[model samples]
Target: MTDTPWLTVVRGTAPLLLSIPHTGTELADLESRLSSPWTARCDTDWWIEKLYDFASGLGATVVRTGISRTVIDLNRDPSGASLYPGQTTTGLCPTETFDGDDLYRHEEDKPDAAEIEERRRTYFDPYHAALQAEIDRLRATHDRIVLYDCHSIRSVLPRLFEGTLPVFNLGTNDGRSTDPALQEKVRGILADTGVSYVVNGRFKGGWITRRYGQPDKGVHALQMELACRGYMREPGDKASPENWPSEYEAAFATPIREKLLTILQSAIAWANG
Candidate 1:
């Protein structure tokens, strides 16, 4: 495996840049602080890198972080404010899982304010730096560039939302992050797939999309948060560390992967048009 302790950047020639921020599982030095290393990585966007492996073939630049979000969520606000205020959400350096399970054995084991800031400097900043550089590079060539942030989550988390999530949850910061036409085109493609999907519903894009999306400036950004069940077999309600993290079977993910390939192709065409 590649020793991507921090982040990995695969440069391509297309106007689209795919950002898989939560796909990493490497905990690095933070592994020692976890009560259960497996639980700490439970919320990772598993197999996302493999699902979008075809992006390189489409000439889409890929930027991914290998460090666990338990270390520092790259999609979160650096100010530690809630992305969905008045609702359940994790933090910059999360101390609990999406299900509200404790990540550390004790409260003292969690990172302090100073440690959170240190993680931002070490992990969060570099990832964004590389993403911004890619956007700048692509923007100079194409009249319009799209930053497609890829993510996935468990289908059900009562603490986060009621009932199961849609198969594809697209967000554009409530339509402020990208042009309405671009958003409509993508939504149209998803709708044709015959899969359940929503726009700017539960997830309205994260810090990365909101911070960089400038439609008027020719840079459009959008986030796609897939429910894991769309691509893989989700664990049962009482799943444990042993039975929870399912292996990535390409055969199982083919349907969604095919749809995603079309989505990326559409995004590239839209950007160039």
Candidate 2:
């Protein structure tokens, strides 16, 4: 067991690697810098790690970061460029929540350019390095490998997007991140479930999916951004910081979990093909 506090990596023999970047709640000393520590982590992919716990049994390697996205978003562009150019989104080190609430009490408490760069070195880099290492390790053993970037968000954040989001938002970087056939396979599975989904929709993949997904190199990457409502209770209309983020109940998520398991298994089958 490695003692690295920033992240956890579970090595598996499967050709699929699961990257759970935003599921972490640990704020370390950074929590003190937040005006609202709880809200700062309110956008976390709540219980997502546990939601996908069955991946390990399928032999899919899991690389998860324990550091909060409020500390440093491992999926954002490291150069400070926005992933969604004209749309609203957070930065490399988010200073606000998904609802556009300020995280710091004062401007002085916010991380400056120097601090952001240091965080990139400390938190962001290692997470990707581990992902890349796993990709490399798996690629050597299999003819093809899949880097499945797992994420989830609030069902509706008008500040970020209009109306509600679909249950599954698949991003293959507009078909540049993975093999076309692989994308179709996953889409086919979702179609069978009769659930709401969008391909190359609002989220067309992020840094990790865009950077490491090289189909020609035999490393296919895809990101599945699920609406939290699919697996947990997301209060409608009256959602406030205090009332939001309902507890995780396995029974409540069983239906969605079963669907997710099928999707993951499909990815593994595709990789092995």
Candidate 3:
């Protein structure tokens, strides 16, 4: 139950592990100086950790970040690689929102290479170190390890996608990052829920999933990007400070939470088999 300022590690006994990358809202000082507080909160996964806090109760280890994505996206590759090549996507450190709008008033306000690297060194590296260490530990105890990367975003961002993203956007790099059976098991669960979902669709895991999901080593990774509208009010109006408050009632979020845990448990069980 120890705490790392950037991330939280919830120790557990299950073979599965959960990585909540976008749940963080702690913006770095430099980041706060670069963008308005509103811009910083706009792209947050927005209470995803709270929504999925039941992971611990389900016997799954949880690793979460408290730092804001605007500081350095834990999900994006540190090499500045594009998760969605030939498509609009944010980087390890994004200068703009998903809607193609500048996050900072001045381009110069953005993190320079040195600053970005510094943020990586300070925030991103430690978070991944913790994640990697947890995976290694869980692998030693369990027959297999599943890294469930949790994320959420506005359902419709024209700058990021042409149309509304399915409620559950599952990504596994077209099956390269995880076992076929494991992938299918998760898809089956989401499918049965009847909550509009697509496989290897808009999001197929991020750096953490792609980098750590080694089926050969008995470590499998999966990323689930949920649309905010599935649980919140991400209206068609321009996304602003006033309309999008970062709060969600548990009663309102319970069903989506259940579906997420269902996917994790099903994946873990299938991995064990």
Using TM-score as the measure, which candidate wins? 2
Count of clashes, each model: 0, 0, 1
TM per candidate comes to 0.97, 0.97, 0.95
Every candidate's CA RMSD: 1.6, 1.1, 1.4
| Cand. 2 Cα-lDDT | 0.90
What's model 3's overall lDDT? 0.83
* TM-score (C-alpha, index-matched) for candidate 3: 0.95
Q: Which structure is stronger by TM-score: 1 or 3?
A: 1
**Superposed model 1: Cα runs more than 4 Å off:** 1-4
Mind giving the per-residue lDDT tens digits that candidate 1 earns over 121-235?
9999998989888998998899899999999998988998999999999999999999999999999999999999999999999999999999999889999999999999888
* lDDT by residue for model 2 (201-268), tens: 99999999999999999999999999989999989764576777799999999999999899889899
Superpose all Cα atoms of candidate 3 onto the true structure and report the RMSD in Å to 1 decimal: 1.4
- List candidate 3 segments past 4 Å from native: none
- Summarize candidate 3's per-residue lDDT along 99-213 as a digit string, tens digits: 7777776867877999989999988898899899999898888878788888888987887777788999998988988889888888888889988999998787889889998
Candidate 3, residue 229: the lDDT equals 78
